[model samples]
Structures are given as structure tokens and as C-alpha cells.
Target: MIKLELIVQVHQLKKQGFKVAAIARKCNLSRTTVYEYLEMDFEEACRWVNELRTREKKLDPYKNQILSWLKEHPDLSASQVSDWLEERCSFTNVGDSTVRSYVRELRELYHIPKTISFRSYEALEELPKGKQTQVDFGEKKVRTTKNKWKKLYVIAFVLSHSRYKYAEWQEHPFTTRDVIRSHENAFEYFGGVTEEIVYDQDKLMIVSENGGDIIYTEEFQAYKQQRGFSVYLCRAADPESKGKIENVVKFIKNNFAKNRVFHQIESWNEQCLAWLDRKGNYQVHNTIKKRPIEVFTLEKLHLREVSYPLSFESNHGSSITRTVHKDNIIKYKSNRYSVPLGTYKPHGDNTVYIRIEQEKLIIQKTPEGVTVATHPLSTGVGQLIKNSDHTRDKSKGIKAYMDTVKESFDNSEEIELFLQEIHKRYPRYIRDQLQIIQRSLRDYGPFVEQALDTCINQRLWSANDLHDVSIHLAKLSEKEIPAVLRDIPLTEASSELIKEKASVRELDGYLRILGGA
Candidate 1:
């Protein structure tokens, strides 16, 4: 038989228009059990529970021993009684449920209540106004007006001193950008920001807590840097460290969201804001014994003025995050687009933000919002839309290659200007261009100085042009070019060209060629 309290809750939820399945979910009961409970009235349920309570139990023979044990230890639980029976009683073939039922009946009949030990808490001194704010996230599954359930996510902020509260609700889980947006809204709602904010180690904002050296997510890091606020991340699994926001999260769920009909997320938020003004903030706090709104008046004076206006609808447009796959691709609308090859990492975050604008998909790196790739929005399903430049091997050290090429030529400034032009014109093929210049330095030797002058003066930014110019200069000086130099393929480009190859001619031959030139 279901307990009288559970039966009452089922009837209450049913009256609230909760379906049988929803009621079962809420009460942690099976659907069949809820159906049976709903079929019975409250009077019948009480009678049924009373009849079942008097029924004989498997452990009835040990009633005296069980009562003695309970008299000795008022704090012993049903599970503990079951364990004691298994250890002390021989051939006591009683299941845990039998012992649990018997123990409950005994406790009710004998007036022996289960003793609970409560932890003692000493209240810490209240923080000064504007010193800190605690922030946390909560989610609740609220029943929509249609009787369907929808889960809504919330990020709540509470001033550590004034206990003033601010909250925002969204139908979807928050992204890093969404968290930043909520922070802006909370700051605006509170009239200003606190000097420091406390947070749990939520992955939406924090990447890792590397032995107390906290690393925040990309966009959140940039936001914190821009907002100029200190962050204190509570130790994992320790909710008491930031109890103010924890209470605020629970309050939002129970007092505001519980049994509230969610028609739409926007209206729900509007209702929540109004509720805060009328009830949440205006009511006298139980602990502080002052209205939160009234306390906020003094706290507001101490708060730092908002550094900027709210930009919830900025030109940048809202974005959603997608994880970059091992193939350097992100899925959007059932299609895939590629980021740069090196964008994926095995251990760290591979997430990127995607924003749609003007019929195009803009894929950007996190935090910085730098565009990594862009493609026309695909209307077809399962299509792979990719930028060919993203396929390039970007892991090679382009800076080291540039440095090697620059040091080869005597006119470093001139070579630097030429390489910069190549980078601008052929960023995708920069490694190839640098490799060509390095090869020319090896084959043509000092003649490359004249080639650099030719390429820079004539605006010949192509590596092919540099190679050809160097060949022409080598010929002009009556130096015999090595057979390997003659055989080098100019038009064909490959990554193999970047690898260092042994010189074909001996040291004396290169010296003789340079001496002749």
C-alpha cells in the first residue's frame, strides 16, 4: 500500500493537471502504482495503509529483540536493523523490505522516533556591500500550459551582503556566451557589479582548476578580463562555500518555478522579474531580518557603476557552440563545415561558435570570436562544405622557416619585406613559398641577393619568380648550376619540398662555384 502522504501528493498533482506518467515521475512511483493510487480516495488510502500496517511480517518473531535494539540505539535505521538481523539472528529469512516495514510500524506504534543528528553551523560575518556576489545555475522541469513538461535553465545571482537576487531563465542550456549575457543582465538588474564574483566550477565558465590556478573558458576569460572582476571558484562538491547563491538557486526553483506554468521562456522571465520585485526582494529575509530590496538600497551605493550598457541584441548576433570533431569539422543543420586542421586537440576543448548571417555560416574560435572559417549556409542534408585552405598543415613552424630564410640573405630588411608580401598574397601556401626561398638560398648561394632585389623591385611575390630570378643571376655570373638544381621541379608543389635534403655537390664544388660567381 502506498503511504497516505504519497497518495495525497498523487491526488494533488492530478488536480494540478499532471498526467499519470508525470505524477509517477514526480512521486518516484511506477505508472501502474500511480493509476491504482489515483483510483482510490484519501479515506480508502488511509484504511488500506492501516490494514497493511497490522499484517504479520516475516520478522515478527524477533519483535522483542528489535525493540530492545531500538531502545538501546534510537538512531538505528531500518537498513541497520536489517543488517543486525542478518548478523545476529540464525535462519531469519527476512528480506530488507520486511524488516523495513516492521521497523516503521514499530516506530509508529511505540512512539520511538528515529533520532537525527544535525550538524552545527556558525554563521560567518556578513561581507561588506559591493564586495562580492555569488552566482550559480539551476534547471527545473516546469509544466507548460499544454500539460507538457519543459525544462528551463536558470542562472541566479545573489549579493553576498544584501542577499539581493537577480535571475534569468532560458529554455536551453547556457553556453559560455549565454553565461556572459546573463552576467550582463544580472549586473544591469542589480544596478551595478560587485568587485568580486563567486562561482562553482561550472564547465560553461571554467575550463579547469589546475591545482588552484583556475582556467576559464575562452569567452568567459575574455569577459572577465574586460569586466575587471576577480573570481573565486568554490572547491568542487562544496556548496556551503557559496551558500547564498545555492539558497538562491533553490529558492528560484521551489518558490518561483515550482508548479509555475511555462507558457514561453520570455514571459516566464518577465514573470520572474516581477515576482522578484513584489515578493522575492520586497519580503523581509528570515536571517537578516530586513527586506532585500531595502538592503540593496545601501548596497547599490557601494556597488561599482556598470562599465557599459547592456548589449543583449548586439550586431554580433547570438551564437551556439558546437564541438569540433576529430576531423576538424563542426556539424550545423545536419551538414558539416571544416575549421583549420589544427583546431582539434585530443585533451583540451575543441568547441567553436557558429553564427548565421546573410545566408552564410560563420564558424569562429571561442572567447576571441575570430572567424576561423565561413561558408554559404547549406540547404542540403549531410553535405560537407569546407574551405580548401583549412586542409593545409598549419602545425609546421612558419615563424622558424621565415627566420631561417631571412637570415640567409644579407639584406634582411629587403628579404623580410618580400616574405611579408608572400604571406599576404599566399597565406595558404606560405610554407611552400618559404621552402622555395630556402632552396634557392642553398642552390644559387650568394646569387639569391640579386634575386631578392629583383623580386622586391618588380613586386614578384611568387616563390616561382624568386627561383627563376636566382637561376638567371646564377647563369649571368657564369656559374655552373648543379644537376640537382636543374632537375628541381619549379611548378610542382609538395610538402616534401620543405624537408631538408643533402646537397648533391661536395663542399669544394660549392666553394668553386661561389668563387667563380
Candidate 2:
């Protein structure tokens, strides 16, 4: 048996960069146990170590002998063994419970009996007044407006002390908003709230749980904080912990709802409430020998009255408020979904509430909460869904538009090669320079060819080089240059003129070719 200190040291040595074997050596524990404690988080390991103290069981002494006896005589019953023990052995103080417990353990270890066996149960102790309430939701098949069967939901709240109950029915499922409204209605019906409410791992509330830690849904967590009530969720596969509301649900269905037709949710609830007042609350004298409503009056002093209406809305609603991104799209689940043109105003306090339902994403403007756009939900992640009428799409920035305009120019090939060279050399200036090039093409027209050709001859990659060339092109677009400027000396004009390789041909060679060759 390992001491509790070894488990703590195993975790400590692992945190200090020790290998598994080294930690095992340091803690004097087997590598398997060390690995197990390591796999557990620090808090889990601490809890497991703290629970190591052994408390003796009453049947611990005879557990092994009972197993051997059951192995030899597989048909022996626990009650028969109890009678034999009292008559034969000196265990006269041993009651049937101790013998039965030992027999149960032996049967499990040896598998000597059938699959089913006797089980023990204890009745739940009733809680004090205003102490606890159990809540649960149930579904029933109902004939709907479409003249077909559909499932309607019922939420039941039952006080554990008095067995008094409150219930509401709805035509469809309960959204988080509907859950809050139902809670408000239930509290209003009881005229007060209990200190704690028990539930059965409801999805509207609990997302997941690990051991003692609970991860609640965002909306439910907010509701818990706002309502100022303690929450208790039954463990997985343990419905009996929240059995009160379960019984209320069954009672509501069996007695009031089974053979009855559900006309509509409102009328059914009105009729159901009247029935609860008359039959359910007024005549409940079974366990306590007093009416549930009469006992509920005594519990009311301990219960807290609803001081204000709860306004805590859950984010789990199909609709949620989200800030529009710079690209005029709202992001949900790592995907950028689109909206209509002008739906998002830059730097304005505008936001939109997005609702996803039935493969459709609805974008509604906030404050007014009007529907602005709708699109089919995309199947991929990190994608941009666009509407055709949307304006100023930042996803396709100005550079893509500039690419299209550049394709229309006659000198586009030379311009592309030049721009690629510029971009590779000075990537940071590409956007500014691309804008300048596009303006030259659009405003200066065919003269950009002259600018690009001049840039090619000068071996210059600067946009300034193109800028100077574009200025000259723009001047020439007005009219031809004056002759005085055009007829400069060769040396001076050669500096500014298009650079062509010089070629010399002798006149003597030409004359010989004409006559005496």
C-alpha cells in the first residue's frame, strides 16, 4: 500500500521535468501508478490521495470465507446462511444485513449466480421547507395545426418538502429564452422560490461534467448567477436524485393529459392549471396526511418571493448579438458569413444579431433588430459567404479590381512584368504603387504605354521613375511637344530620348556597292 505522500511527490517530480522512471524512483511508486497519477490533473490526484484512508467495513472479516462457501455451494441463499451462522458459529451478534452484504460481495466476485439478484433501497428523506425543488422537462405527442402528430414539451417544477408542483406546456421545444420564461412562470405560480433547484443534466443548462466539476451552458450559467439560486444536477445515469420532478411529469401525463385532447398550448395549460388546483393540490393527503396546498402555506414563510422579473437572456438563442467585422461580415464558429450591401457601416455603433435555423443564416440589424440578409449555411470553415448586391467587399480588395483593369490595357504584359519586379523588390509599397498605376491607366489612357516603355529602357523599378514618365505622357496627351525642345543637340537629347544601340555605316562602302564593287 502506497502512502499519500508518494502520490503528491509523484506529481511534484513530474512538474520538475523528471522522466517517468525517475519520478517513480523518487516517489518509490510503480511506473504504472505514477503514470496514472500523472494522467490525472493536479486537483484530481490530490483528491485521490486524500481519500486513501481506509475505514473498516463490518463484513470485511468474513468476506473471503463467504466467497469460498458460495463457490462450493452455488445454490445457498444469503438468508439461509444467516440462519446457519446464528445456530452453528458464535457470530450471534451478526445480523442478516451483514451476512447479506458478504453474500452479495461473494456473488459478484465468483459470478456463481444468475444475472439478477436481490437489491437494497432506502427511501429519500424529505427536505425542509423552502429547501429544494426538482425541475425537469417532458415531451408528449400532440395533434398540431398541421393536422399531424408533433411533440410538445412540458416543464414541471416540484417542491421537495410539500410535494406541491407547477407545470407549463409549449407547442415546440424550449429555447433558452423559453426556459427562463418558464422558470419565471413557475416561480410566479409558487409565489416564491426555493433555496436550491435540482435537475437532470439538462442540455439547456449543463454542457458537460467531469467528476465534481460542472461545465454549464453560457446562458444557464448567467441565469444561475442572476437568479441567485443554488443549482444541483444529478449525476450521469442517476435519475432518482431528481425524482420529484420526474414523478410530477409522469403524473401530469398519466392523470390529466393521457386521454385528453390538446386543443392548443394556452388552452391546455389553462385547463391543466385548473385541474392541478382542484384535484392535485387540494387532495394530497397520502404521505404527509395533509393537503399539499395547506402544507405549502407553511413552507411559504421560508421561500423568497420574486422581487423582480428576470431579464437574463441566453446567448444560446438562435439569435445572438455580434459585432460586424471590418469586412462587412459577422464571424460565427470560425466562419465569416456574409450580409447585404451597406449592412455594416464603418466606425458606426451598428451591430447585427445573427440567427441560424434550418440551414439558413439570418442577419438582423440590432437596436431595430430588422432582418437585413440571409444566406445558406456553408459547410466549410474560415470561408467568406458573399451576396451579389453587397458593396465594397473587403474580401476582394482593390488589388483584385486593379488586376481586372490592368488586363484591359494594350501594354498590359510589359506593365505586369514591371509591376511584378516592383512588388518583389519593395513588397510594402505594392499597394500604393498599384493604385498609382491603375490611375495612370484609367486617366492617362494609351499614354501609359509610353511611361512603361521609358521605364523599361531606363532600368528603373521605382514608381517615381514611372511617375516622371507618366507626367511626360500626360503632357504629350494635351498636344505634341514644341519643335525647339524636340530638336536639342544629340548629346543633350540622347539623355532624354529613347535609348537605342548606335549603328555606324561608312559612305565609302555604300558608294563601292553602287559602282565598282
Candidate 3:
């Protein structure tokens, strides 16, 4: 079939005294095909082409295979299918545009959706004043927010009853410290905190969930005591329960964000705070039908008043133990710091207790807790923190080396039990397994001791099993360090309070003595 314009051109060429063969050659068509259009009008040409163009397409051969693939993997995209055809099915000539068009038509014919749909939920009931507040985090990409396109996260806190909202923006993801600090600011913004606050199972707060049990993060568990409030974690996979905060996150992005200009993040935060005062909290809420500031009056009565910001203080005379390596060094937070050359005997029985005193690393002898070495804590990870005096006497005598080996294999109950169990259970491989345990101890120190105990108790047969257990335990130990003071119940208010207070005083006394020295 030929185009109407081509038919007109052919007739025009024929009228110019050109032969049918000449017209066919000039128009790039067969003489017989050119004759079909020579005497036809424009409408007749279009009708002729339309009549036969409905014939089968090249994709008809693989229609069944493509449909089966789409049904099995709804997420498989058109371009991906095209690439799959090129590589797997030898359909190298297949175009993405053709595939997409066919896929769209297939979707319409088969009732297959292009994307998954979620049911939108709206809150029907409202909790009483101070009974609940919702919390969540949101991210935004902004062009004017910084000198370049910047990605920022906003932590939003919303009162479920009053609809009062508090939001803080940061240039980076919210860390545990940032979460605690944001709560302080939010409470201050609302003038107090609710009795029970709802959360979206955020990692900064919730560590893990087992069935119905929720394990809060180590730092947040401490903050719960300091601030004295009930924590309400939303169920996993149930996003609808925390709908209020989610909407607040969107409201912030839309009203305060769209078409808005920003120069600095700090200035943006200040602007956000001002906007909340003038527009966010001040405006009449669509659901509650009252200003958040006015509704907060009733909620404020049940809310907890803040006397001080409840932030996690890492250590207060608390200690963490690490084993010294053969190189007269110990590992802490990805950095290695040196101890005295003879500090670690090959025996590996000795332990070092580190107290993070302000900005300094106070390394002390375990059991006695005597200050043995100190170095300013390293600022960067993967760095070697060294003290020249600690490296003296690298060339010790043979007897000294023998004694070093003897000391390492002594004093550890964990190592002793591991050897005993190895001898009783697998006497033939005892030497090899003992060597593995010693290697684990030299590398991981006291951290691997608990794992060895678990491995022995469980009768795990191989050295690799013990090593795996040790590594798992080491990770848990690291997670335990976002420290806060443990809360002891004050039954005897005066006496129990003194005990809690005493720990802080003890830390102070140690610091004072060190300060004098």
C-alpha cells in the first residue's frame, strides 16, 4: 500500500509524460504496485493501505511466552523484557517501544495492574489530650535548600489529640543522638511531652521485634527512664496505625516546601519553626477543627514537663574490656592504639579496661582497674594511634617469650572450659581447636569469651562454629555501647537515690584524682 501523497506524486509524474516504469523507479516501488496507485485518488490510497495493514505482527509468535512471563513476574519491566528477548530468545530486533505498547494492551486485556495498590486509611477516633502523639521521619530533595541539590531528613512529632506538630530538619539521616535531641526540642516546642508517644518502628528507637515483644534500642531504653513516658511502637507492616504523623510529614513538604526558597539548612530550620508558629500550629486543623496551640491547653496538663534535656551520656566510670595484641596494641572503634611492649604476654590472660573520659581514652588494668595507659581518642576510623614509649624492648629474651606464652594460656575461665570440653568431647582435635580458640582470643579478646562458652555449651563441633558464635557476640557487644545510666527503682527514695547518685560522684572522684596528677 502506498501513501496518499505518494499516489498524488505518481499521478503528477505520469501527467509529466513519465512512463509507469520510470514512476516506479523514481518512487521506489514495483511497477505493478505503482500502477495500483496511478489512477487512485488520495482517499482510495489511504483505504487500500488501511485494509491490509491489520495483518499479524512479528510479536505474535512469542505472545504466549511474553504473557506467561508478565503473569509470573509483574515487576519485570518492558525494557527488561526486551533485553531478555535479545539475550535469551534470539529476538534481537525487538524494540522497547513495541514491547511497551504490547504490554499496555496486554494489561488492559488481562486486567493486570502496572503497579501494586495500597488502601488509604483515615483515623476515625481521636485519643484524649496528652494520651498520644505520633512520630516519624521524612526526606526531601530540594534545589534551593543549599548551594547544590541537597537531600535532607525531617523528624516530625504530632500530638494525636490536639494535632500540635513539631518538626526538625537535618542535612543527614537521624542518628540516635539526633533522635534524642529532636525529642527534647519537640517537647520544648509543644511545652511538654505526651504520656504515650507512637513511633513507626524506626531503627533509631526500636532495635528488633519478636512476635509481640518490641526491644527498644539501648540508648532509647535509657531515655524512657530519664523522661518517664510510655513508648507505643506501631506494628511492623502496619503503616496505617501511624497515619497522623505520615500525613503531617506530607503537609510539611507541600505547604512549607513547594516552590519555597532556602539558602542554608540552619536558616531553613529557623524558617520552618517560624512557619509552624504562624501557620502550622496556629491554623485550625482540618480534622480536629481547632487551632493546635489552643487544643494543646488541655493536653498540656497530662504532658510531662521537662527540667533538663534527656540525652544519653556514654560512660560514667563504666568500663569496656579489650585484649592487647602481639604488636602491643588494642582495637577500639576501628582504630588501634598501643600499650607497653610487655603489656600483652603471649598467654593473653590480661585484659585492658577503657573508660572514655571526655575526649581522652583512659586505658586501665582490668580487675584492679588501675590507669595503665592513656591516649587522646582518635578522631578518624582505621587509624593507628601510637605512643612511642609503649614500643620499647622489642628484642626480649627467649625466657621472656616463653613466660609470655604461658601467661596467655592461663587465668581465663572461658579458655579453660573450652579446652576441658574439647578434651572430653573431641580429644583427637583438641590441639587444633585450642589453637583456634587462642587465635580467636588474640584477635577478639574478652568479646569472644562469651561466644566460646555458648559454643561449648551447645557442643558446636568445629573451630569455625566457635568463630561464628564469637563474631555474632562481638556485634551485640558493639550495639550495647550507646550507653545511658541504668535506672534503679527508688523504693527507699532517700537511700536508693543516694546509690544512683553515688555512681556519678564516684566517676567525679576518679576524674579529680586524675586531674590532680
Candidate 4:
């Protein structure tokens, strides 16, 4: 194309009586095409030359803008720039082909100047089994209930030798808490530990950047110090250093998350785990020729035992605004948790640290780290509470029951009565039921009385219901007691009621006779 353009220019010069050899020397075209153009009529020659190069000149305007953008943002390539221009400015004259050609031309002109430097990655000569693992976050497209598309982040890990992969959807924000929790979960799932973990330099881990120095986040540094696991971070913007984990991320997303239908993030994660065990690890890898599970079994012996006792505190270090409601409940994550009255502003913001474990929230004073309160998982939008000591105490009723037992009967007699009563009441083995009742007594305190009352009223013994009700009582505030007790109708039954009812299990039968259940 360049030679043809030069030939036309040289031939035009020759028509003005310049020597063909001189034209060739100046324009860098061969003498042959230049002579042909010179022999042709001006109209025919111009038409032939334009046919060869007209499209390029036609897109010159749009191509210039694309070149300018690429110069401004060197990281952006021609196609990306073309898409941007197409959306924002509707650069009508340039197509993708033209943009590509212009980029090629620019690169040729400034080849040496625009070259990017990359550090060569060395292949691992031999990795001891379970000696190292690599971690990364992979994104997959998921649809919301409204059918809108969103990217879900999954944490991906790969064992160095076995190439065994583990992945789970990260339902929470990518925070230091999330990172630590993911590590714990992965370790538990793998049933072992690796000596070293290679990680991306996530912001949660790298707190600050000072030239070539990276300051680790306080939470991450604490974890490393306590756990005794060596940390290796990939160089900034270099993902290939952790290529095994990167490939695991791609494989899990494509094979597991992409193929499944899920209603919740947790459900998707669980499905991925099951799929990894059954379909992914069980199948022979195309390159490795052995099943991942088989390879992992061989490598498991090489993994080091977890070096230190595992104990973790929540990284609740966040700037939170305490929102107070009229009901004295502070809202978090669409559910209501209680705070001391007048400590928070109505419709205003105050900072607090909320340490979450599973679904439980432990609200704490920010600077002091003193536990202000703990809340069970909330059911709905609000809670009603009174200011009291933050400690959860449920021993009052149990102590009262023990005192009554002690006072009313001989020690041996009371023990025999309790055992015989429990054995007679339960259809299954009594020991499990006794343990369940004991746990409920500890958790529910006096509210265990209500659970007992529920059992007595229904003439049924249910350990599961006792446990569930105790948990429910732990979540309820003093204000909710009146309403809950009223709903259960437990306190006011008379001897007449007992005589009329015959048995607690018959209450439902009685209700059924009255067309209620």
C-alpha cells in the first residue's frame, strides 16, 4: 500500500517532466509502477490510485481521534478506544478495521519508545506437596431476582502440586474479615494447611504504598504473626505469578457457577463445593492425566500440620453510622439490633464497631473495644430494648429450680425423680434430651420456664422446640415479653383448665374440636 501511494506521487512528479529515475529516488517507488501511471491519462490514473487507498483516507478523521485517545491512555488498545468513541461521540467515519490499522501505524512509528517491560516468570522446578497454596478472587456474572446482571466475587485457592481447587462465593464485601474468614473456611475444607500462601496484594492486606515498600494492614499482619504461615504476594498488576490460582478461578466459574441455578449466594457456594468434589476433582485433568483427588491424596502427606492454634477475632474496624429508631433499635443490614437508649441520635449517625460471627452481631464501643451489647439474628425491621448490663445471664431460673429441688426433696430422691420423669416423658434415649434441656436452660435463663410451660401445656416433650424457643428468647427484649407470653397464653391456666384438658397433647385436639389448631 505504501509503495502504491509512492508510485502515484512519483508518476505525478514525472508528468511535470521530472526524470523517472529521479522521481523513484525521491518518492521511494520502483520505476515500473511509476512509468505505468505516467503513461495513463490523468483521470484513469487518479481513479486507479484512489481505488487502492480511498477507504484509508475516508476514515482519517475518526482515526485521528482514536490515535489521540491511545496516546492519552497508553494502557488502552485500539478496539477499546473505538468502542468508547462509538458510544460517547459516535465517530461515524471509522470502523474497527480502520482503528486497528491506525494503531498498527502508530506502533510502527514509535516501536522502541512505546514498548512495555514485563518481568519473566520462572516455572517452579518442583513444589513439595501441600507446601504452598495460592489465593485469588474471580468474578462471575450472576443475575439478581429482578433479572439484572451483576458480578459476584468467588474466592479461589489451588494447592501447588495436586492442583486441587477450592472456591466459594463471597457474600460479603471484600474486607480483611472476609479474607481471614475465607482462609479459615478453605483450611477446614481441605482438612489440612500449607506452609505458605501466595496472595494478590489486595487493599485489605496492603494498607499503604510508599515507593517500592508495602505496608501490611494491621489485621492481616496480626493473622500472619499468630498463624505462622509464610505470606507471598504477587507483584502489582502481575497475575501470572499466581497462575495456578488464576486458572482455578476460571475453571470453577466456568464449570460450576456458570452451569448451576441458584436462589442465594450461599446455595451457589454449596453447590460449587459439591460439584468440585463430584465432577471437577474426580475427573482427570487434561494436562495432568490423574484425577485431582488422587493427586491430592498423594500430596496430603506433604502438607504441614497447622503450625499454631487457630483463634480469630473479628476485624470490625469500620466507620459505621449508628441509626436510632423510635423503638430503640439500631438498624444494620435491613435487620434491627438494639443499642442503649439515648446513646445514639434519632435519624443521625454515630460510629460503632459491629463484629459479626455467623449471623450474630456483637456491637462494641469503637475505641475502647468494650462489648456494649450482643444481638441474636433479628427477624424483621425493629427491636425494643431497655438499657441493662451487657452480659447475657440466663442462670436465674436454673438456680431457682435447683434451689427448689434442693429444698423440697432429699438429694437422691430429687435425682431419681428427675431421671425417672425424663425417661418416662421422652420416647427416645433420655441423655440427649437431658443435654438439650440443659443447654436451653443456660441459653434462655428464665425463658426456659416458658419453654417448659409450652411443653406442659401441649402435653408433649420436644427437645428441639425447647432449643429453638430458648434461642428465640435470647433474641427477645424485656419489652417483647408481655406480647410473647400473651401469644402463648402460658401463665393463667387454672386447675379447672387442667381437669378439662386431660393432657397437654390434647390441647390441639381440643382446639381442633373448636375449629382451631
Q: Which prediction has the highest TM-score against the true structure?
A: 1
Q: How do the residues 215-327 of candidate 3 rate in per-residue lDDT, one tens digit apiece?
A: 77766788888888898888878878888898999999889875567677789999999999999999999877899989888788878688775423333224356667778
* lDDT by residue (tens digit), candidate 1, 1-517: 5489899999999999999988887899999999999999978998998987777767778899999999999999998888888788863577877778789879989999999997678889989999999999999999999987778889999998999999999875676667888888888898888999999998778878977999887778888988889999999888889988888899989999998998997799999999999988998999999999999999999998886854543743445777788899988767889888889876465667777889999888853567888899999989999998787766467887888788877888998898889998998789888888888888997888888888888989888899999999878777555765878766545546756587787788887978963
C-alpha lDDT (0 to 100) for residue 54 of candidate 2 = 47
Candidate 2, 1-517: lDDT as tens digits: 2445566677788778999976776667789988887777757766665664345666667667666667777878898777766666645667787778668756876677833465476887779999998999988876555655656778888888998888888765565567777888888889889999998886667767788798876767888888889989899888878867777899888887764766777798999899889977787647778888998989988898888876443332344556676667887655777775566554243456767779988888752467777888888988888776565444356458557756855777777788778877865466677777777767776777788888988878966777778888788756755776677666867666657667989989988999965
For residue 456, model 3's alpha carbon misses the true position, in angstroms, by: 43
Q: What lDDT would candidate 3 get against the real structure?
A: 0.76
Q: List per-candidate RMSD values in Å.
A: 14.4, 21.2, 28.7, 23.6
lDDT of 4 by residue, 1-517 (tens): 5645655676578668888776775676678856776777657766776786555464565655756766777777667867887797876566788777667776666551344667876656658787899998877776666655556778888888888888878544455556777777788677778889998877667755556576777767888777678878788788888888888888888877763555787677778888899987888877678898999988887776654435543433243335344555565655667765555543233445666768777776663477667777665655543334322333454445444433422344533444456657762345466567667666676776665555555654556676787677667766678887767644456645766744356567878888985
lDDT of 1: 0.85
Summing lDDT over every window of 10 consecutive residues in candidate 2, give the lowest-scoring window. Answer: 311-320
Q: Give the TM-score of candidate 2.
A: 0.46
Model 1 TM-score, all chains together: 0.58
**Candidate 2 Cα outliers beyond 4 Å, as residue runs:** 1-114, 117-119, 283-290, 311-517
Model 3: which residue pairs collide?
A: 346-404, 347-407, 347-408, 347-409, 348-408
Q: Of 2 and 3, which scores higher on TM-score?
A: 3
Write down the TM-score of every candidate.
0.58, 0.46, 0.47, 0.44
Each candidate's clash count: 1, 0, 5, 5
- Name model 3 segments beyond 4 Å from true: 1-101, 105-123, 144-146, 258-261, 311-517
Model 1 root-mean-square deviation: 14.4
Off by over 4 Å in 1: 1-31, 34-47, 58-119, 309-313, 322-350, 354-517
